[model samples]
Target: MIDPSAPLPRPRSDLTEPPDVPQVLTGALRVLQGRLLLHVSPARVGYFRPQLDAGRSGLVLCGPNALQQARKLRGAEQFGGPLLVDPAVYEVRAASGDEPFPNACEDTFAFDDPLAVSLAEQRAVGVTAPMSPTGYLHAEDSEALKAAVRQVAALDDPQVVFAAPVDVGWLREEDSVRQLIACLRLVPGPKALMLGGQMDPLARHPRSVDHLRRIVAEVPGAALLRTDLAAFGALAAGAAFTAFGAGSRLRHIVAPGEKAKTSKNFSTSPHVLFPELMHFFLGKTLADRFAGAAAPVCGCAVCEGVRALDSFASNAGDRQTRAAAHNVAVLMEWLRTLTALPSGRARQQWWHERCLAAVDRYPLLNAQLLQPNGFKVPPQLKRWALAAPADEAASARADANDYRRS
Candidate 1:
C-alpha cells in the first residue's frame, strides 16, 4: 500500500542514468546461487542477519520501517549484498526507522502506489505492475494503472517485469490488453513479464490457463511466464517460466488444521506443507515429470539433490517455509535442466517431466507442516496464523457488523 497522505519522498532524477542491469543481475546471480532470498520485517532484521551470512543472497525488507533498519546493515556487517525495500503506500506510516541520512544509501525499493508517480521516478533494474482478476478487480482502477505506467515510462528503466492476471485493473481482457499495448508503446525496449496464478489442484479450472495464455500473448516485452507446476507442462510448450516465490497464501490444498487457513504472514512465512499432504495435493507422478526436466539454477540449492521423487520429498519438511524452500530448490533444478537441454523436442520433454515431479511433491510436504503439532513456527507466525473457530458465530457476526459500519 502506498502512503497517499505522507509527503512524497524527494525524487532523484539523476538515477535517470540507465543502470548497468546486466552487470548488476550477474552479480546478484553469483550471490543467489545456492543462497536464499531472505525477507525480514523491521523488527526481525536481527534474526535474519545470521541466516544471510549462512547463505543468503539478499533480503526484501517489507516496509519503510524495515528499510530504515536495513540501512544499518550496509557494508560487511550485513549478510547479503543489497537490501530491498518494498514500500506499501496506501496504508500505515512507514515501518522504516529514521530515514537514511545521506539519501544515496537506499539499495532496493519496491513501490506499490497507484497515485504517487515517484515510485517510477527511482531508476531500478526493473519496474512492474501487478494486475490480477480475483481481488480488487475494478475497472475504475484503470486511471491509477495509467498513472503507474506514465511514471515507469518517465523513469525509462530498461528492464520491466509485468506481474499477474491483467484483468484485475481493467474491465475485461480486451481492455486490459489494450492498456498493456498502450503501455508497451510507451516503454517498448528490453523488458520481462511474468504471469502469476494461485493454484487450486482439487478444483481445477480452464479459465486459469486460458487467462494466462491470453495475457502472455498480449503483454509486451514478456520474456518469462509462470503458472502452477501442474499447468507448467502446457505453458512450457511455448514460454519459459520462473517458479513463484514466497507469497502463496490460500494456494495450498493439503495443510493441517488451522495451518490450512490463510493468515497475515502467508505471503512472508517460511513454513512448508507436509510431504504426505503434498503427495495427495500435488501427486508423486507430477514430481517425476518435473524432476525429469531438472535444470541448473544459478541461485538455488534445492535442485542439487539427485534422487527419487519420494526421497526428495522425504527430505523436505511439512511446514510452509520448508515446503516453499523445497519448491524453490526443485525449481532451480528445472531451470538448470531447461537451460542445459539442446534445442530439440526430446530435450523439452525431458525438462517437462522433471518439473512435474518436483511440483507434485510440494503439496504433501505443505500438508504435513500445517499440523498443529508438526512444524514449530516462531511465536509471531503462530499468532499470525490463528483464526477464529467456526463456533465463534456471535463474535464473527459482531466483527462483520463492525466491519460493515466502518
Candidate 2:
C-alpha cells in the first residue's frame, strides 16, 4: 500500500533532466532506458517475463481488457514493480454515451475489487481516477470530481493516483487550474495528470504552452503523463515526466465510445520520429534522402546492427522494435540536452534554435512547419529561420555528420 503522507515522485535530480520513461512493448524494453513503463494487455501478459528478467525498474500499466485478464491469471504478483490499473473509463463512457462526470464504480474498475485488492496486497497498484469525455473543467464540476476522488480514496490501499484527463485549454484559465488543483488535493498519494484529446492543437498553440508552464510551476509534484509525441515539449517545459505508447498510432487519445481497430498489417517498419519537424519517416524515405551518402540515420544498437547487415527493412516485429528503440534514444538525447541548459529560458532558446536549424537543413519539411495545425515555431525560431537560400550540400554534410556521431 502506498503511504498517503509520502510526497509525490519528484525528479531524481534537479541538475539532471527527468528520465525518459517510455511506455514500451515487451521486445523494445531491451533497448530502451532501464526505467520503463510497460503497456500491457491481458492477452500479452505472457510477454512480461522477458522484461522482468532484464532486471529493469518499471511499472506495469494494465489496459482495460488486461485488467480483467489479470484477475483471472493472477499476473500482478509476477511483476517486480508497481502495478497500475487503467480503468479505461473513457472507453466505457464512449460505449455507453454517459455524461463525463459522476462516474459510477460499476461502470469502471473499482479499487476495492477483490482482484485489485489482492494486487495491492502483494505490490501496490495505481488507481486511475475517472475522467470526463468532453474535456471540460470548471468550478461547477467540483462536486462530481470530488465524487470520483472519493471513490479512489475509499480503496484500502492504492500506490498512486492518476487524475482523469482534462482539456488542454483548461490550463489556459487560472480558474480551471485552481479547480483541477482542488480535485488533485483530494488524492492522497503520488499523482499524475493525464492530458486528454489530440495534442496537435496544444502543440501549435503558444498560449497553451505558456499556461502549461504556469501549471507546472504551480504544481511541481504532479507529473504529466501524455499519450502523444507532444510529451517532448511538456518535459522540456518542466513536466516531472512524460510517456507515449510504443506504437506510432498510440500517440493520440481515443475518445469515449470510440472503437479502436487493430492494424491488419502486424509487421512493423523501420522509422524515426523527428521531433523538430514533428513527423515520422520510414527507413525507405530516409534512405532516399541520403541516396549516395552514408547517413547515420540512427545510432541505436538495433539500428547499428541493422546497418551492418545493410538491410533497412526486415521482419515486422524486428522493424517495430528497432524503430521504437531509435525513437526512444533520440528522445532521451534531446531531453538530456534540454535539461543540461542553465535555466528554463535557456532550454526554450535551445529548442527554438534546434527547430530553426532543422527547417534550414530539411527544406522539404517547410510545408509541415508552416502548416496551420503544425508545430507553432516560437518567435525566436521564426527569427532564426533561414533568411536566404539554404546550402543543400552543406546541410546534407552536417546531417550526415550529426547522424554519424549520434
User: Model 1 shows how many backbone clashes?
Assistant: 70
TM-score of each: 0.43, 0.57
Tell me the lDDT of model 2 at 206.
44
What stretches of model 1 exceed 4 Å from their correct place? Answer: 1-61, 64-66, 69-84, 90-140, 159-175, 181-185, 188-205, 217-220, 223-243, 247-328, 342-406
Global local distance difference test of model 2? 0.44
Where is model 2 more than 4 Å wrong at Cα?
1-57, 60-83, 94-143, 150-158, 172-174, 199-201, 204-206, 259-271, 275-278, 282-296, 305-317, 332-361, 364-406
Q: What tens-digit string does per-residue lDDT give for candidate 2 at 1-406?
A: 1123323334347424432222221222223222224344445444333323232223334344645554444444544343344444444342111233324345445433432443343232222221122222322344444455555556523233444555455555555555565555455443455554443435533455545544554453344553544454444444444454444333444444444543333243455665445455555554444454444444543355345212344344555445555565555556556656754445545655675676564554434334333333433233333211124435767998999999
- Error in Å for residue 273 of model 2: 2.2
Q: What do the candidate models score in CA lDDT, each in turn?
A: 0.34, 0.44
In candidate 1, residue 282 scores what lDDT? Answer: 29
**Poorest lDDT segment (10 consecutive residues) of candidate 1:** 93-102
